[model samples]
Target chain A: MSCRIGMDVGGTNVVTGLFDSEGRLLRRSKVRTIKLSSCELIQQLAGQCKEILAAEGVRESELEAVGIGLPGFIQSESGVVSSANLPFNDVPVATRLQQLLGVPVAVENDVKMVVYGEYLHGAGKGYSHVLGLTIGTGMASAWVSDGRLHEGAGGLAGEIGHISFPDISYMCGCGMKGCLETVASTAGIARQARDGLKAGWVGLLAERFPPEIRDELTSHDVWQAYLDGDAFAGQVFQRTANWLSRVLVPSIALLSPDVIIVGGGVAAAGDIFFDSLRSYVSASLHPLYRERLRIVPPSLGDDGGLYGSAEFALKSRKIGLRI
Target chain B: MSCRIGMDVGGTNVVTGLFDSEGRLLRRSKVRTIKLSSCELIQQLAGQCKEILAAEGVRESELEAVGIGLPGFIQSESGVVSSANLPFNDVPVATRLQQLLGVPVAVENDVKMVVYGEYLHGAGKGYSHVLGLTIGTGMASAWVSDGRLHEGAGGLAGEIGHISFPDISYMCGCGMKGCLETVASTAGIARQARDGLKAGWVGLLAERFPPEIRDELTSHDVWQAYLDGDAFAGQVFQRTANWLSRVLVPSIALLSPDVIIVGGGVAAAGDIFFDSLRSYVSASLHPLYRERLRIVPPSLGDDGGLYGSAEFALKSRKIGLRI
Candidate 1:
């Protein structure tokens, strides 16, 4: 009757899963994130966990542990989270959650949790060294080598989004000019289309989205135009791929990972995006590094964090209020 | 009576060192590299090793192992080398040298060897995760995490030289345009000065070296001018620092090493170059990453590879003809 609860807390939503002893999902639930204080958010998350467990007819004593994946600067050892999107600034999430749930809880950066999930159960299942890149509202990456994650000294490793792209003059949100995030993220892709529309290179984007609604146009609109064979949209994706390749070239040279698991919203673009990314990266890499390197999308999809957190909680036997 | 021979084979010179059981340097020797064939080159390296051992009065039986650091693509498992500057094209260096010296031999890439050297005994001592950047003829980097090297899947991790700089139009030796090596290396710095001279911005360089012999201008000449308050030379160094910072920004973001050990010819520029690099990198990095990051010069200087190679050989047991 032993069970575990895995939770993924994001800006808009909180997803929780009830997994049985064998690591199989027994039940799942989703609720809108409460943007109140840290204490209130933890209370809401606890309620969601209890609701999911009850739906599966599981007893509170049968719940062995709970694991969470949070977005932002997460200090794994301290379980402290400081995120721009969440109301967590130096908030000790694991301590509060454990106190409420009466079970041990483990916390990790959402991106890293996704990577661990992929490495353990997805596209990176058999790869000895895996680099997972999450290209969504923001750019983030995580690495798992020899079954252990490398969080660097500050636990801020894989923050490649801030890498400068000298050719770019756009101001990044990080107060730096020309950061890779200025163009590599999903928001960056939409901004590219908007910039083009304003600069008169409109093409199908202007015809479809129009200037009145341009500010609200998403990366999906740009991708739609590219699928419709719009040259300008194609150019935008091409530029994104090239700039991404510039970053990947260094990554490949530095890590030489066997497989690069690319997840997040970008995976929805399918082969068109994958082909462009693979070719651009391959063309720039040395023959020595180009051999045996595979770049693929994650097989776990949105459930990566759920599985990753459940597995992480199950594996970490000595979890307590470390903070 | 236990001793070891450490050899570093470069394009211009072959350096060898004899180390006692306690890893202390007992004697050293240097000779010009033989660029005839792989066989002759291996023979030359073998002779250098033997000469150093004889000078130290260490017999073949007393010499526990011989280790060589070669410049180029090296397969540690296979002990094969392929380099641009050397005559080694898939050469079985460890096997050939072990046969000639009647002792176990270990071979590694020159840059990685230097990094391992620094990690074990120099700037990287006491640091758990260390990143070593060698900026000489070309730019290369290596990482040591948890006291073990991350060689990637292809054993070619840390090849940041070829990472593209989209702003520059210069073609790299690797057939890519605007690689980091195009501007971050000593040769690249000299090339920048020469290109400026050709474009009619010949400041102190023209006054000092003159156009008649400007074709032979080296990074040393550029550094000399910068030391004498030359505005143009200062700009060249600043540009190099900025470009190098662009690369390091990504490196810091991805690796988050406690210390970045900068070595090779660029280290000779001292604080003038180091200060510029540190400031630029700090300016771009997020405060989260900027904290506790130290950029330092290697303490072992030219002897890093020697110590690293000897330590590598002594540590690697069951050595045989790996190739």
Candidate 2:
């Protein structure tokens, strides 16, 4: 039986999955990501893939291809990755991995892979145009149309996180001021709450987390506080939703996507976040667009990128044969 | 010789162009668009198509298809047009025209057609992903990827004119406040200049046009005054360029098209407009994106939609036959 391996390479860990020809996950494995040179990191990823196949009782010759989802700027056409999260700087990942495994390989941006997985099996199924927004430690988006990713000319598409928001003074890690991600991401929400606490805003956060631990606050704590009826925490999520709508409104007006998939850690905040985002975006959009567009939470959870990468490998192999 | 006819149907007039199989324009004709019912308007369009073919000495049987570019909502799959500019309200434009001419017919948004034209034979040639911005009386955009228009699921993809701008209170015709078109478009520029004049700001506009004809102030007059060293007129264009950047920056970050073709009446403002817009956008975009993207002026001039619609009809005929 032909099988494929899909790897989700992140800053802290690398998760690899074994998938059958039909895209069903058979087994999974994880390894810590250590700071290493580009060559060493590629070898580590290659080792993980081999171990997953061996442990699943599959021979190396039985493998069809491997797909990897990595963070940062991925030029899939060139198989190069340039991202701050990983020790990759214009690294030709696909070529290196294919050499190590002696099989075909495909690589894409992690968020894009997540969106693709959703497009194939989750909230985006049957949709022609999908705009996927991932609000994690940072905010980014990806677009999928007709089963193919719209990677733009230079593969820098879907960087809505870096778009400058009006009247915002926060400095983004991108070296730009007022980027949407500076105030809309998981880190952004936590930062907002921390700023409020430092400014001496009296709220549940100060009464509970206290001054010493204020610096250690996470978006989860603020969300929990909001759930517990904290007014200040409520405003943080509300403002994030509003800033998020600024990005979505233009996206809706420009793309008219069938579905806007809100995924990542921020999405885990659930109804409190989604309800306000949906209502704000709907109210801001023209009735023509509002009536047809669906904004929904992702369903596949963490394995979306794995599923997407495996499926992408199978599809890429088919395309390779055709060419 | 086999040929196609493309019609650009606008509120003021209808311009039709006959093209040979190779997509070269062979003949052109125009007629005023008067108020008429949907049925009457369809009949009028048919008459215009027939007249254009007859004038070019091309028999009806020699025509392959007819394509029309119209303002407002176009559901090309169903051949229906629901536009506010013309009498077409869910009218089956393609079906009616095909019936009258006994040839295949296609309909698309006017802006999409213009973008398609540019992609095929103008500044957007040799590029895979193209984003076209049309800043006329109102602002709008269209995208073409690999020679196919990204029409979105609901066929309302390129309505950027309706996206609200922060801090602007001017009401848009779309019933939204602070729409980008409220200040970035040709009409919007004139409106700002008029507002400045009406508020008793000192400038050449008041000294020349005076209060009586102030209501009749046009973008052309403002451009001319700016060229002649009117600080108020200069500020109007400068601010308009700034607002235009707000739309372009997000578009760049999200779409990352190889080329952004700036077209329509406002492009006529020349360097005084494009120079400022380009610099602001270039400064704002990350070097990764800025290096590969080209922000260019439209090359097809007034006939972009005409060329695009004709080419689209020919392509549609091929698709129709394959199905």
Candidate 3:
């Protein structure tokens, strides 16, 4: 049976999965992502791919093309020009993987892959126009307009976190201030809570929540508090939702996708985030799209990148032809 | 010679043009918008298409397709479901126009169509990433990601104006407070200057500009006064650009297009707006994308939208096309 391997390169781990033509996960594995040089990281990734194939009793020659999903920008023709959260730079990942593994490989933005995977299988299933979003340590989205990944010029489309905001209250890791990422992502949640604590606003967070919540609250904790009815915590999520809506409105007004597939750890806050966001955007959208908008949670979750890479590899290689 | 007709449906007029495959506008004509009911407007738009094609000596059978670019969200499949500016209410503009013209027709969000046009031709030419913007009585943008139109799921992708802000001094047509359209648009400039004047701030606008500019100074007049070294006028444009930047930061950060095509009556203000705004965004972009951002003027002038609508039609028809 022909199979494809998918590699999702991230800050803390490299997740690789084998998928069949049907997008079924044949097997999957992960590896630690130490602060290695880009060269070393590439070598390690190649080695890991080989090891996984061996352990699964699959021959090296049995593999098909590989697809890599990156967390940041990928220039046209050049695989990955740069990524912020990960220490990647001018890395020709696709070419390198092709040379190392002796197989064809495709490198795409991770969010795009996720959006594509979701469209083919997960939350976006049955929708022709789907939007895949991953809002965690940072916020990124992929636009699948008319059943295709919307890669902006030079493969840098769907970089939604950099959309500007109303203030310079927070600094985005992308080097800009007041990016949606600085306020609505998990990083933003922690920043907001920390700023609140520093400003002497007390909440049940001190007693009911742990160090994770007090030190750096994720979107999940904030949502939990909102569900628990803590005013400060609830307001934080509410404000974040409004901020998200602010960023979403202009995009929605302009693009008008068929479905919004929200992913990332922050999205795990579930209905707390999606519900408020849906209502806020609905009530606030142009009458052209008020009721037409559907705020959906991505079903693929954390493994979406892995799934996306596999599907992309299989589709590009055709017939799931293995190496 | 293969040809297609593009129609820009505005509240005041329905402009139509005939173009060859090279995107050359061979002929142009227009008709006043019909005040008939919503269904009648669709028919009127169809009539305009017929008139334009008939005048151009192009038989309906000779045309490949017709493209209608309107001012709102176009549900995928259900043509022209809603528009805040136009009178069409869930009007099947594509089917009606196709039936009337005896050819295939595609209807898209007018703003998206313009951006698509520019991406393929005018300002967006030679670049993979380009943002097409139009600022008039209202503001809108078409986000072209990697040569594809970005329609978010539910077909509500590029709502750039509806992005929210704090301390909203303007009311947006989208029914949202603090939307970017409320402030950065020429309408916004007029409202701000007029309201500022009402609040008793003094300036040279009282004696120099017309009702639109003097009574409610636009970015155009503000820049003129600033050129004359009026600090107050400079302040107004600066504030206006600041809001534009504020909305732009997160929006652009998320999807860092290499070029932000700023057009419209407001953008006509020239350096008075771009100079300060560019500097601000440069100082504020997230580090991830700060190095790749550029704010440039729209290459396509008044005709950009007409051309963009043609682009939408070409892509929809899936014919080997050029900008």
Q: How many steric clashes between backbone atoms does each model show?
A: 2, 0, 67
Share of native interface contacts recovered by each model: 0.70, 0.69, 0.65
Per-residue lDDT of A248 in model 3: 70
Cα lDDT tens digits for candidate 3, B1-323? 77888888887788888898777998888778856678688778777766777887777667887787887767755565577677767777777766776767788878777777777777778776676666666677767766767666555566667766557756666566767788777778777766666666665765565445455455666667768876777777778778777557656654568788877777777887789888877766555456676777777665666887876777777753211
- Kindly indicate the candidate among 2 and 3 with the higher TM-score: 2
Which DockQ-derived CAPRI band holds candidate 2?
medium
Residues A1-323 of candidate 2 have per-residue lDDT tens digits of 98999899999899999998788899999899878888989999999988998898999999999988988888767688898999999888998888998998999989989899999988898999999989988788889988887888777888888877557889889887878888899999999999988888786888987887788899999999999889899888888888888778878888889999999888788887888898888776677888897889998888889988888878877888211
**Candidate 1: clashing pairs of residues:** A253-B158, A254-B158
lDDT of each: 0.84, 0.86, 0.72
For model 2 chain A, the run of ten residues with the poorest summed lDDT? A314-323
Which tens-of-lDDT digit does each residue in B76-186 have in candidate 2? 687788888899887888888878878888998899998999999998999999999899877789989877788887778988888775588898888878778888888
State, as a TM-score between 0 and 1, how close model 2 is to the true structure: 0.95
Best by lDDT: 2
Across A1-323, the per-residue lDDT of candidate 3 in tens digits comes to 56678888888888888776566887888888878888888888889789878877888888877888877777645564477756677777777778999987888877788878888888888877776677888787777656556665445566677765556466566555567778878878867866765676666754565555567565566667667777787667767777777667655665666778887777777776788888788766666577677888878766778887787776666643222
